[model samples]
Target: MNKELQKLLRQINDKKNEVKSLVNDGKLDKARAAKEELKALQEKFDLLFDLDEEEHEGIEDKVSRGTAKVIGGEKADKKNLVKSFVNIIKAGFLHVEPDEADVKVYKDALTSDATPNDEGQQGIGVTIPEDIRTDIIELRRSSDNLEQYVNVEGVTTKTGTRNIEVDAESTPFDNVDEAADFPEMDEPVFEPIEYKVKKKGGILKMTAELLEDTAANIMAYINKWIAKKTKATRNAMILKVLNTMTVGKEVVVSNLDSLKDIFNEQLDPAVAATSIVITNQSGFNFLDKLKDSDGNYILQKDPTLQTKGKLLFGEYPIVKLSKKTLKSKQILAEDGTTVTGYKHPVFCGDLKEAITLFDRNVLTIDINDKGSGMWEKDLTGIKVRDRFDVQPVDKGAVIKGEITEVVNG
Candidate 1:
């Protein structure tokens, strides 16, 4: 070994140690200086290592993974396992918890080397965050009548492209004094303003480990949502899914890849059975096992399967359900909550998609009779606001106001 070459090798190792200390101390400036020194030392190393004829391609060593992976098992999978993984992502702990990775690096004055944290030094000046820059092509803008969807990744994937109506137009308000006399009042002339906005995004890329953590977070949130929605829908969807997989009353996994990994089917059925039992012991599927054939639909024994018309208050609907399905009944939703089926099931019928509707009774105002003691029977050509106040409600509607004095023959 040449004496000079050995000295340069030792210098590189010392610089590597200095970079670690600087990074650990959160001294980004000193760390950068140490990194530059290491880069210079690497050039010298290349010359020395290349003294012999190189038989390889342009790049010497190949990276197995594009990015790093955080692995953890039995001993260290504690309550704060996520934190441990993030510690590796950041290459070390920081004084502040930056909301995003790039923000953390920027606040710590990160350079390319400070990013990927490769070679364990401040890293090569790779703009880690600015890797996936994208631009939006705004196809259309919202008008007074309808609006179109934006072509963002999440929107396109989840909602698909569709023309949707939106209340994007803003109404102009005119100053009005209700206390003043009608002659002096300025009837606030109203108009709406319509406009649109476009969005531009910066580049974004993530380490494999970072992406896994993010995916885990999204899964956790979605699972929480599924749990809450399960109750609201009365355990309808997931219960149905679970029941399809269950044999008799017990949950039997006919096929599960993760389960196969843990215990082979050839090993023992008891282990798999026990695992399924414990997994489903959450009481979440209690309603699922209860079937309509046993007569427990809607939690009422001998429950009426046929839909019935609402008999609001003491007055009952004049129609009755026949063996034949009701048709041509218009579904209406006013209060926008509790929906009921009218002549037909307003919620479900020949409709392509599942939906709910509410019935809002139409109001007709009659003219006041002589002396205003009674109202005229005629109700025609009356403006909605003139004859009566039409108040829309979920279960029932309300109509209360002064009748028009003029009656139409």
Candidate 2:
């Protein structure tokens, strides 16, 4: 199957170049014929790549709670509460001496589930107040991969295992006749993915002057930093899991011709109908350069244009990552020369079915205004932690393409 697809793509690319040259030389008739041939080949490729959603039951439907869309519902007002909390924390760090009412506002924002301190106060160690937790969660959701691809679950406990049914039922349904033999029934395979809370944090050093500058939008600055660090940490972990998944299909493409083959093959018809091609910005830039022999861009923009700025390769949406993210492992040329840069991996398929993420949902923060050694320096320490794991449940749904510099042209 791969060999056939590869051959077909090479033919298209070759024909495209030929048609362009023919038209440039005023051979309109020849160009038209070649264009017709290209059209036929494209139709065939599309047929092979078109996945029937009814035939392939998505793994997410089996056990996914959908991606988290924080900052909605009855808790909409929590958005402001979160900002208020940040302001209170900023005051503490700067010794700004906020009013008694301000302290109460920050404390009151703690989550209901927060373990009370000895003084029966809300939350532990200046942790993100409950109302503000939504903001943090929403920020984490901004991770390029986490919210888009992974099956995000909001779990309550810090340590636990997610029991997932890995396999579909093996029995075939058959019509029964009077006293017909019964078909054998099989149970789905269940597996547990254990997740532990991992700590990720950063300390912001505020100058006494900046802290004391009441006019400064310190809350916004702190919030942006919090969101940035949170996404970086969580997305890194998500990438780790995705890059290692047992891809159901893979193709090595050294040139545009072969790249198209791999791209088509990755769109498995057995998976869900909605699919996305994941690549970094550099990889997308390479794709952007792909042109038909007629000098028209081969990559099509999404016709509907309602995909939140997602471009399309045929019907599949492309999710562009930041530069260097989604990188392929190092490669060596056939002549034994080392490939200098990363061959960014182009991941494509029904990501919702391909990856599962277990999120503990709670962002725990521990603040130390006076650590044993820090008291002397008057440094305030903020520690944040969250629990989550990204795992592949249906590896067959994903296809990977390791793209190197050779494919750029």
Candidate 3:
């Protein structure tokens, strides 16, 4: 590389570091300005390089070519990326330089802009590959993750509004005489629900000794930790929205008739057809043991080949969460005394219509070795940030009820 190009590259790197610092301090405006300057420097470097227009050789393209050449004309796999990621993390923690291949992959995976979302800026770090992110998501889904049941919308901005029909099922088309003057119909009402993305994250502190382990082991540990934390955080937010919905009717744990009332009487036929039952472990136990007059279990195995699970009332799919995930609440008893109630909430309805999860689809990690006591303790703080929000849509679509008995205070 020419001296001029090398100088421009150094300038670009310095500008990137500046932008990252500004973003970390929540100075988005300044970070954006610095990013613009970095872009100009990059364009200047590109012009000086004088690459072929047909190839369109950008920095990432050059990095990929170099990586390919260094790896003996072989494509870099997930293992390579994983090792590179671990090396980058170690380099950040130890204040040392990473391997050439590691740096190449890291640069190749770099996002175009440091601050993708204006409202919530990501910290300084390497963005993991898409496959690794997919792995984390898959791990979350392996358990009782509530995201699978609700409607999830990927949003770019931090805040937005969604217009939903007032009553989609009731709004029917009017029939008029052919070629005749059409009668005026009532306008369908739409309610706009605004959603603002919230940042949820935590620091995963690791001992320096763990950095000596194999890259695959380090990757597995990190992926599992992130998946568990993100899943629990999202589940809590989703349940908070679910709790806001008014209960249409109370359900008796031993009474099958009362449980059936939610679907038969409380919910519309259209809604009942697509409704599902979500409850905690205690609630599931009660429903799972319930039998009809003929002594046949109400919850039957799903017969369809496409779906595999036990269906409640031979129709509605049932999802059971752990007690830790779905916590209990304290309620006032009839005697005017406080009681700890294990109100195992059993929610039944079309969850997709009831709630929407606006996912920013951005997960970032920043490593800090100089943070409080890190140098002395030889620990690295890995901060993970996930952006998303949960909001209620049609509150009437879902009905909430308790199955567990309350204890006296």
TM-score of candidate 1 relative to the true fold:
0.15
Estimate the TM-score for candidate 2.
0.64
lDDT of 2: 0.58
lDDT of 2 by residue, 1-409 (tens): 2335435544654566567657755789998998999899867865653443431233224324442122222342554555555555665454454333333345345432332132421222344655555555565564274565767765444456666676453435767789988766566677777766564566654444445544336545555667777777777877776677844445664656765664455445556366677788777777778876788675786777655544544667777778755565665656667565556677767777777776655555544455455556665565555556666667767777766664331
**Candidate order by decreasing TM-score:** 3, 2, 1
In candidate 3, position 187 carries an lDDT of 87
Deviating ranges (above 4 Å) for candidate 1:
52-409
TM-score-best of 1 and 2: 2
- The residue ranges of model 2 lying beyond 4 angstroms of the native Cα positions read 1-108, 115-124, 137-145, 167-172, 177-184, 213-216, 247-250, 255-267, 292-295, 304-310, 332-342, 368-381, 406-409
> What clash pairs does model 2 have?
110-130, 111-130
Worst 10 residues of 2 by lDDT: 115-124
Clashes of 3: 0
**Which residue pairs in candidate 3 collide?**
none
The lDDT-based order of candidates, best leading, equals 3, 2, 1
Q: CA lDDT, every prediction?
A: 0.27, 0.58, 0.75
What are the models' TM-scores? 0.15, 0.64, 0.76
